[model samples]
Target: MQIKSVFIVEDDPSLQSLYEKILSYYGYTILGVARNGEEAVKMFVDFQLKPDIIIMDHRLPVKDGIEASKEILIYEKKAKILFASADKTIKDAALSIGITRFIEKPFDISVLIENIKELIDVKI
Candidate 1:
């Protein structure tokens, strides 16, 4: 299945814009961008057009990434959540909740793009 839609959950405004722009440049339709985990979940649930991919950040206001992912997963088990974080401590926590894909901080944009593309191409 080709991934066409994407949502970004990040606290930083710059990062949010960057992701939106870069992903759009790659031809992915941007569903929306959320600043916090709470907002992310709300957007997911409320929006009629469900996203094909969600780029989630670890640390967030109101709710952390793991908590938000759990909530969303409950609603959409097959949701492909791409966890992004600088903190190494979150790997286990993220994986425990079935979020297997991760992009480390300070990563190259090319690497991030490659990972997202790979995810969209995967059948599972």
Candidate 2:
């Protein structure tokens, strides 16, 4: 299925805004914004908002993305999660939890967009 909507779990405001702008430009709907994993879970549950894809940060307050993703995936097994982090340890942790895509922080916007497009195309 084509990824039309995306949920972003990012703690950094600047990066969050940049991602929102870039993804919106690509015609992907921004379902909601959460500053941390706790908020993300709350938003997902309260709104029952299901996005086609999820762009998550590895390090987050309250719960962290890996735990949140695990919980979210329990509800939606087909959930596609792309994790981003500056720390290799965090990325490794995410991967160990079965997260397939890992994007390094301070990434080029163009590269990020292309990766997102590719993930959406693959539908995994």
Candidate 3:
């Protein structure tokens, strides 16, 4: 199977860097990073080749992750989006829209990595 690319939509710079590093180490391409929901939505919409997966954060400026996820899925129904967030309340709402999965904030890096791998299998 081809290597998968991942788009990160987190507002925290440190977390973004960490995810980028770990994903790169694991052989997944880092498609791009968006600092907020609005940017994430725009990046997904504008990209010629959509990333294989999206790592999204719930709290954000301009737009929340839930809305952004909704918008992206509207365009690409099968896109795998991992909604990683500290806000657990959005879990049900996010899952309702067909996000691949949710990984809670302050999560073990191993857990996140495992989820990404699982999504990759699904994609394949």
Candidate 4:
């Protein structure tokens, strides 16, 4: 199987590290990490080779995931982003903006891995 690449956008350092280690262990190439939504958008736009998936958090400094996702999607309509957030209220807003995957926070790592796999397997 071809190794899928992932981009992580999270503010918490511990979660970021954990995601990097866990996803890497699962054979997904962690392309890079962004600590804020603004940084995430900029990095995604400038990526020489865009990641196959993006794990995004809603609450962030500088900008929130929703706005950043809107910007990124405008640039790349098919960008696959997985909304990984604790804020349950924003699910509908996220989905409205074309983010098809939503994984609530405090989720099992295995679930996250499975979701990533499913998103990567999708032919969109």
Candidate 4: where is the Cα deviation over 4 Å?
Answer: none
Model 2 TM-score is 0.88
lDDT of each: 0.89, 0.82, 0.90, 0.93
Among these predictions, the greatest TM-score belongs to 4
The TM-scores of all predictions, comma-separated, are: 0.94, 0.88, 0.95, 0.97
What CA root-mean-square deviation does each model show from the true structure? 1.5, 2.0, 1.3, 0.7
Judged by whole-model lDDT over C-alpha atoms, candidate 1 comes out at: 0.89
Off by over 4 Å in 2: 1-3, 47-49
lDDT of 3 at 89: 82
Per-residue lDDT over 1-124 for candidate 2, one digit per residue giving the tens place of the 0 to 100 score: 4558888999999989988999998889999999999898777776566877789987899988889988777767777788888887677778777676898887898878877778777755
User: Residue 11 deviation, candidate 1, in Å?
Assistant: 0.8
Q: Candidate 3 lDDT, tens digit per residue, 2-58?
A: 998999998989999999999999999999999989999899999999998999999
Which scores better on lDDT, 1 or 2? Answer: 1
Q: List runs of model 1 lying over 4 Å from the truth.
A: 1-3
Cα RMSD (Å) between model 2 and the true structure? 2.0
The lDDT leader among the candidates is 4
